[model samples]
Target: MRKTVIVQDSPPSVRLVQVGTEQAGQRIDNFLLRLCKGVPKSHIYKAIRSGEVRVNKGRTSADYRVEEGDTVRIPPIRLPRADEPRPVPPASFPVIYEDDAMLVINKPAGVAVHGGSGVSFGVIEQLRAARPQAPFLELAHRLDRETSGLLIIAKKRKALVALHDMMREGGGRKHYQALVVGDWVNDRQHIRLPLLKWLTAAGERRVRVDAQGKAAHTIITMQKRYGRYSLVGAELRTGRTHQIRVHLASSGHPIVGDDKYGSDEVRAHFARLGLERMFLHAGRLELPHPLSGEPLRLEAPLPPACLKILDYLEQHS
Candidate 1:
């Protein structure tokens, strides 16, 4: 959208601006969120719902995509106090691989990928602040905040689009390592379940196995079994929210320390055993290079605590 040229400092008023190529296709709410920095999300949603924000001179919802040259009317919003500018903390993460097109990071548990749901800052926000010179950076996939390991970030728009396509078509192979609560009897198993996302009575997001839900596929391969736990490799053929965790849990073996799906007793027991975080890790990612025809297999070793738990399980079991 047209930047400072449309708004004057002293004489602030309703400004109708034309969308630019770079800003095109972005949801008006997101566009407004960036433009109206520091404004609370509730205010943004209310403004859109109240028709205070207009696209192409017509009232639009928050999900409407802004087209190039489309006129967007932005209401005069109160700016955040000059003395209290919330800044994205520039934090560095362990870098696994990096190139002109993509970057791979071994993300740690408890850090959100992007801020929302009470999180003030996430990997993307921090990465943007870390390198102000970088023009474009976007997450290619998501990992649960409590899960740690390999994550991909695209440095170019084309790369992001290609990665999305690869993931959507099931061309990319994503595998995670999880320590479950019980021994895995099968050497290998394919789980084809329809998963439906629903809100619990407490308004928390949850997924359940339902015939009416979207199709999801996961392949569980037995790796090693402990006296009371099993280390399994989960290969996802279709990516869905909490796919691996939910699939394994549905099969009667919830992941250890998975507060969302695991048994409370098991989680508590594992926490007391020093496995404070979810015992799942995105240990490997394999796909053809988006630009190059060459094959690419990226791997991230489990964190020290996870390895120590595995060692303990091995030695004790």
Candidate 2:
């Protein structure tokens, strides 16, 4: 059974009557070890050190003094579990454009942009697995896992270098489609926000708009609208982590299925409409060819799942 106890005073008191008898003057971490059997000592120490396990309803140092009736709130442990079996590589990921120097793919939603952490395989890995003899294919940029659409991969080192340089020179055009929570009256608007990195309790990276952070800019155009939601097109002038999602959310028009930034009402409404993933897609990309020097433009059609949601909205609206 689980139980909760409130800390009402300093040197927070804890009553672990069922687990073990309290020992006076013991370090908080040591006391927790006796109370929580089979749990790693390091884990307990980390919890105390990180301030997750609090004393007296306040953050405390690991060396915090403890008394007979002090209350301690020991948060449950959360550790990364062992790796699971790898997912099977897709038989074929649709190719939107291909040439000697570079290739563009219409990446499906639920597929990672690149491999990291315990993810042994991602779109880039699968692509290399499919073409073992290809020199090397490097991702020019990245899209979120739940986002689908045009992604460019360079087939050679030279191509990768050229494409990276082109991106830096502002020579590429990227367009995205997103379903936002509210009707936007303005046909076109520019969002200039700065983004800063934050690390969560679980050590996951997140981005937020702060004046002290890196500059980001995006241009939004109203593509169409339903009763309450609007399908908008976004063009990024400066690429930043979750730039569009953060900007639109800050404007009080969060993207559908974006639980991190979207409102609960919007999330529930989209869920009722069968939207399971973020309703965003990288629809179009235009850049100069690495080898041919010709302008290369590619379009990735909306995935079937995205279309289904749009179709439902059309019918209901």
Candidate 3:
């Protein structure tokens, strides 16, 4: 059963018998934990810590004093797991931006950009399946499986060829936002590192900065600071495989939650801080329209999970 109460100086009335509790003196968190046994403890603690649970229509700490006959307002509980499956479209992507030659989408993380070895379903394939009448869509760029952001797709072969030419000629720009370890001493710095592409022990493609590698450069500026970590804005001068991650790692500050270049100790530290994935995102992109030659800019906001972690750090630290 659910209960609601209005905020007033007088304590609201709660019928303890309704919730199978006639006892008092239990802490609010403890009582709620008992009342909602199926919910994750972490989530309950989070809500309590965030002041979402209140006692007597007033904000109370998790350890607040509880008396008999006191009223409590329990916010609607959010289930840990999804309750319904995502709606899958019969045809192509939900286009966020479109013009005569190019299309953009809020590409979800965990979906590959193109088909590879054993994978048959990728963004391209799904688009084709949904829009059989349109010719095959071409990728203007690629994003890793764990990254989410605006993605550009070319509708015509000529458009793809032209975009590729522009990128090769250093006519395109890309910017990323990353939560990295360590407090940057300088407000802005440039990383000029060469990257060599190689396969990992598990046969996954990876890149590292080496003397003999292809040239890569990125400019980084500090956006915000949270104790040992800082949110940074990265502008790419040249596109290379894992360029931002490699350059930042080489500079002695790997991105937080980065499993590839960061050590296990660093990963564990971030985990303890409640980060579940690599603290990196493709924040924005800028380029000329493939056919019209007009400039276009696209931006994506940080995901809620990422922001939640940041908020925790800020409040606790």
The lDDT of each candidate is 0.85, 0.76, 0.72
Is 1 or 2 the stronger prediction by lDDT?
1
Report the lDDT tens digits of candidate 1 across residue range 92-122: 8999888999999999988899878788778
TM-scores, one per candidate: 0.91, 0.70, 0.67
The best candidate by TM-score is 1
TM-score of 2: 0.70
The model with the greater lDDT, 2 or 3, is: 2
In candidate 1, the residue pairs with backbone N, CA or C atoms under 3 Å apart (3 or more residues apart, or in different chains) clash, namely: none
Clashes of each: 0, 7, 2
lDDT ranking, high to low? 1, 2, 3
Consecutive 10-residue window with the lowest summed lDDT within model 1: 2-11
| Comparison by lDDT, 1 against 3, better one | 1
lDDT for model 1, on a 0 to 1 scale? 0.85
Task: Let me know the TM-score candidate 1 reaches against the reference structure.
Answer: 0.91
Ranking by TM-score: 1, 2, 3
